[model samples]
Target: MLIGIPKEIKNHEYRVGMVPASVRELIENNHEVIIETNAGIGIGFSDQDYIAAGASIEDTAAAIFAKADMIVKVKEPLAVERAMLRQGQILFTYLHLAPDLPQTLDLIDSKAICIAYETVIDTQGRLPLLAPMSEVAGRMAIQAGAQTLEKSNQGSGMLLGGVPGVAPAKVVIIGGGMVGNNAAQMAVGLGADVTILDRNIDTLRSLNIQFGSKVKVIYSTLDVLEAEVLAADLVIGAVLIPGAAAPKLVTRDHISKMKPGSAIVDVAIDQGGCFETSHATTHQDPTYIVDEVVHYCVANMPGAVAKTSTFALNNATLPYIIKLANLGYKKALENDQGLLEGLNVINGKLTCKSVAEAHNLPYVTAKTALAI
Candidate 1:
């Protein structure tokens, strides 16, 4: 099998799909890997690095897309890249399709085998592929929020960890999952008053045990969420709903009621965001004010830290990529139920129930689709 790696083209996206080490692993398995010229340059891997690992470097994305059996990418293919997708070709990447109707439509029309890294699950029912980036985003959320809170950035001019005789800023996280956990870790480390809200009692209990009174774990209800948001100096929207759009837990009314100059870091912006005023912003211009509340909704938060993110992502995705290349998508997916869950679109059919339901499209089970 021929695996292709193309340079990510998203705005300010610097992470590469495959690193030199990952390419070497494929080569050791007797697979041919072709990477577009300068694909890994953003992450400090030179073309010579890939060549040293026995990868053939192509000069253009068109050639890589056209000739490769499977396309491995860090982010979802952009509009131009999506246009190049052929029927039956494999696309392995993060496809946040629920919130992006146009991308979903394009993928459906391309008739490609789209396996979303974010949707893949492990035996423990954890999102293994999405974990690394989620962890990065979660940690970065606090950093972004802290920066946004500076007075020059139109924020409340409050330090996350206040000095002696000054009370620390209140940090409220909207979920108790991976993103929330990491955010809480950062917030608590900085001596802020940290609180996490979630509907899952088990998760809340787990958090309570993990922090042991350092962080407050609250049962999330609408009233409780609103109250927490209103009191927070920095609100981190870390909610997720797998392949579905993130629920808008913080409404416009809530934002309006928030303290002036407070900041919101919507880490769930990739899944359409948990905040009603959230819109996907780029690193170039990462924040916007809504009702005097600063909104930091950079959709690709992990991209800002390219080298670490690329390596971490490659660690989690390489095994699955190897499986797909060696056994083919059908056999590899059939062998692993979790991998099958990654199959969102195959042969022009939407195989993800959440994605199909999001757009009112017909849903086909992965098994049924593959069987055909």
Candidate 2:
């Protein structure tokens, strides 16, 4: 099989799909790997590194796409790259299709096999591919929010880790999943008061047991969410629903209820934010004021740390990529249930139930889609 790695073209996106070591692994498995020129540069891997690893480098994305059977990417295809997709080709990437009707339609029309990394599930019912990036984004949310809280940034001029005789900031996290957990860990480590809310009672119990009174775990009801937001100095929106759009937990009215100059870091902005006022911002310009409340909702938060993110992402995705390349997507899906769950759109049909439901399209089970 011929595998292609293209340079990520999203605004402020610097992570590459594959690194030199991963290419070497593919070569060892007897697969031909093709990388577009300087594809690994953002991640600090040079073209010479890939060449030394026995991989071929192409000068253009068109050249790489023309010959490769499978295309591995770090992010969803942009408009220009979407136009370059070919029928019967394999696209393995993080395709958050719920929010973008145009991109979803384009993928279907292209008649390509689209396996979304975010939708893949492990036996433990955990999102393995999405977890790594979520961990990165979650930790960074606090760092970004703390920066935005400085008076220079139009924030409340409060310090996250306050000095003696000064009160520490109140940090409220909206979910108890991977993103929220990491964010809470960071906030608590900085000596701030942290509260995490979730709809799952059992998960909340687990969190309470794990944290052991260090942080507050509350049952997430509208009233509880409102109360927490009203008193919070930093609000981190970490809600996620896999392939579906993130449910809006913070409404415009809620934003108005927040204290003046408080900061909201919506980590779910990529899947349509959990805040009513949150829009996809770039790392260059990552904040906006809504009702005097600052919103930092950069869709690709991990992109800010290109080298770390690329290596972390590659570590999690390489095994699956190897399976897909060696056995072919169909055979690999047939062999591993985890890999089967990654199938979103294949040959122009919608396979992920959440994605199809999000757009009112016909739905097919992942099992049924793989059989085709």
Candidate number with greatest lDDT? 1
Clash number for candidate 2? 0
Candidate 2 ranges with C-alpha deviation above 4 Å? none
> For residues 1-372, what per-residue lDDT tens digits would candidate 2 score against the true structure?
999999998988999998898999999999999999999888688899999998999999998888989999999998888888899899999999999889999998888999999989999989999999999999999999999999999999999989999999999999999999999889988988899999999879988988878899999998999999999999999999989999998999999989999999999999999999999999989999999999999999999999899889999999999999989888898998987888988888888888888899997887887677
Give candidate 1's root-mean-square deviation (CA, Å): 0.6
Q: What would the TM-scores of all predictions be? A: 0.99, 0.98
The clash count of every prediction, one per candidate, is 0, 0
227: Cα error in model 1, Å: 0.8
Q: Residues 1-372, candidate 1, lDDT per residue (tens digit)?
A: 999998899999999999999999999999999999999888888999999999999999999999999999988889999999999999999999999999999999999999999999999999999999999999999999999999999999999999999999999999999999999999999999999999999999999999998999999988999899999999999999999999898999999999999999999998999999999999999999999999999999999999999999999999999999999999999999999999999998899999888889898899999999
Q: After superposition, how far is residue 354 of candidate 1 from its true place, in Å?
A: 0.6
Q: After superposition, how far is residue 322 of candidate 1 from its true place, in Å?
A: 0.5
The TM-score measured for candidate 1 stands at: 0.99
Residue pairs in clash, model 2: none
